[model samples]
Target chain A: MDVSQELADYAAKHTTQVLERSQPVQVDMGLLAAFDNTPIDPSEYSSDLDAHLLQLTLTSTQALISALFALPTTPSAEHGPVIRPPVPSTILPREKPLPKPKEPTKWERFAQAKGISHKKRDKKEWDEERQEWVARWGRDGKNKQKEEEWATPVKAGMEADQDPAATARAERKARTAKNEKQHRSNLAQAAASSSASSRRTAQQARAADLERSMLVSKSATASMGKFDKSIEGEPKSRGVKRKFDENVPKAGWKGEKEGLLGVLKSVESGLGRKEKRKGETKEGEVVVRKAVRYHDREERLKAGRGGAGGGRGRGGARGRGRK
Target chain B: MRPLTDEETKAVFEKLANFIGKNLVHLIDRDEDDAYCFRLHKDRVYYLPLSMLHLATSIARPNLVSVGTCFGKFSKSGKFKLGVTSLDWLAKYAKYKVWIKPAGELPFLYGNHVVKAHLGRITEDTPEHQGVVVYNMADVPLGFGVTARSTLDTRKLDPMGIIVFHQADVGEFLRDEDTMF
Candidate 1:
């Protein structure tokens, strides 16, 4: 919209010029003869105090902008004393163009494109701790409170019935803290009162600790070397695998020439017989046994239950094979 | 893990069917075609392509473990290795078996011997070619093994010879650390 042009058009349409019969101007020379013309000093005008009156003809928007910037007055080429109308800002268009409309933000554009008109980008959510609305997302400026909370050491929750080890640890920690506090108080009291006795007790405690540690540090005081290996229960030695001779038979196994029967009989008797002379030598020829099939598989599959016609095939006399 | 979808369930069933047909088909008799049934492990349910169930009176192994998705798990390895609970089951079904007495268990688990004579009863049906379970006298499967020699050839051979090659043991799972020297 051309705001200036619209204002001018509205003014032109509404305003009416009064035109009556025009005559020559009459000067009042009789009043000027008694009145003296006095010139005001130009130096008397203060830049801070002086303001050019806005014309009634200009639009309110234009008048406001001109007054705000104190539009500079330049002398016209022909007129030395008269100030020319202020030059328009570079922001004004060279040619006619539409007025600059307010641009929407990125979130506003996204919301608009997505058809979500109700989204308010600057709206805040509730914060319980602060007891007021604060920005909870995206570049929160106030994080000191959260940082302070983080810096603090959180206490662990204690169970109603404390475990033995946990209670022991707690007791130890408490005792150590109490000792440290007592030591600190003792040092402070000593320093305040300038007493020398506190230092003596501390030295005595240190000497006692050193003596106890030295006694405890003695190497292998409870030596088992003085006792016999038998009394020491096998001497805690790692057991090696049983040595193999390959020619000699293992504990329950028989010699290669002794045969499987000898080994089996020996195993039954729970003895590892070294010589083959003790076992009986079978004089008869050895026979290798093949797998004993109790029933023929094909026959079993076809008609093992006396199904009529198994020997007669699938189409024999019924019940003729068996009673 | 989320329940497998219908397609996944179907796929699981198909895989299961293929496994059963590969492993248990030769063991059961021809008339007893439908000898076993099991639920295919899928997140969701689907129709099973069961080969056998109605034909056999009972399942082949009642205490079969389920393995799915996790690779190298017992049943998921795709090679069916049955854990033996019944000695009767092993004697009746496995084409070959090597029975060991209690005395030889230590040497066997120590990876020392496969066919040590004094161990216990050994089966002659074993042709010594394929994977087989080594069973103790108590019928407990101690380890998995592969037969080292042909059944006909092994009889003439020495009894102290290594008849079975040790593959894996139950104790190996307990502690895999190297034994003390």
Candidate 2:
């Protein structure tokens, strides 16, 4: 047991750790071959330096001598610049800009003439035959046509605001449009209110317009014709059939079979009789007026064009013989 | 004003369909089927259904491309040519995206081929050879691209090789074509 303990202790104590020794170490010259400490001769170095210098001198001498000898032939101080005869002056020497682009040759012009043009798209052609402007795309747009028709007219309303005549025409046009619209809306509103109301009001409106027009024509005719004020309340001879006078207000007169002729004849007969008029004078009379306004609309429009050619003798020779 | 012929109307309808898939059935008001009004250079105009510009504005907020536009252009002949602007607007919602790193921004913007290593990341599941948006690291879209490599191999890619075609880039706006790379 004791021996084991001693062996264990010895094993524990026995370690690979080295002890630090503070003693100075000595070197022996005889133990190892001595290295010579003396410096080597500088001849190799000097010879290498001489060789480098000689090489430099030879290269410099060859290059410098050649350069000096060839100086006369090469571009030197006396020569201004390397004149490149082939090239014209460039920006470097501040010469004029290169020649302006040359005109296209004949063949080029031909090719261009034959080339398709993009200008067609922007062109607006006046179709004089159709009396309208034709556009490049999709039959000159409908919207543009509409604006031209409707909006241009409105702009005309603005264009001649300063000219009294034009302004008056514009105002009349506006008034006409407003009146038409108002009448339409009133009708609509009435119809919405009640069908009977709408019908009655429309009938009234038509009657009012007819009566006003007839009265206006009668006054105009009386003023033009030889209306004797002395016989205003007297009857004419019953057997004497009145002659048709063309001098009467022909301004609004149409054929006897059409328009207000029958009513006018009846009213005039009453006026001549000097009796209390009661036939067509009822306030609520339907009094529908049908004027035979016959003409091809296109022809009428064409005829009215160019501000010329209309039956313009409305202020007729007031029976020049009678005058 | 010239009312559109049946053929021209049909052509315009086809164009609108191709441009927006004709899917905006909600935008069509049958009564006022006069939405596609076009004012022409010659002071001519007409109305048709589908006011695409109005619809785009209501939907696009202030991000309208070619601002104040209605999402269609006109040919010289006055025909409506649609969809050039719609493509750019729709690219933002596209799934395939390549985010370029900051170091590669200039090259990418200059219409250079986007190298795989220079990309920060490619969104997962992006298909190869499909159109994609090229985005900077800040997540702002630079322009469009065609993916040249698969999304899976984005990390381990052949060095200095192209990853996507710089189809259209911000460089078109940043610098002139002559000065750009």
Indicate which candidate wins on TM-score.
2
What DockQ results do all the predictions give, each relative to the true complex? 0.02, 0.01
Ten contiguous residues with the weakest lDDT in model 1 chain B: B41-50
Error of 2 at A229 (Å): 81
Q: Score candidate 1 by lDDT.
A: 0.44
Q: Model 2's CAPRI class?
A: incorrect
TM-scores of the candidates in the order shown:
0.23, 0.23
List runs of model 2 lying over 4 Å from the truth.
Answer: A1-323, B1-88, B153-156, B174-181
lDDT of 1 by residue, B1-181 (tens): 1223233333333333221322333222223333222233222221111232122224343442322212121234343333222223333445456777788787777766577463466665444445566778888777656667755556666768877777655555444534200
Alpha carbon lDDT at A127, candidate 2? 68
What is candidate 2's lDDT per residue for A163-265, written digit by digit as tens? 4444555765676688788667655754544555445666678977776665445457646424734335332222356443231223422331132233333
TM-score of 1: 0.23
Model 1, A82-160: lDDT tens digits are 4334344324346867655544544456689999867445556667877887764335633223433433333477564
State in Å the error of residue A15, model 1: 99
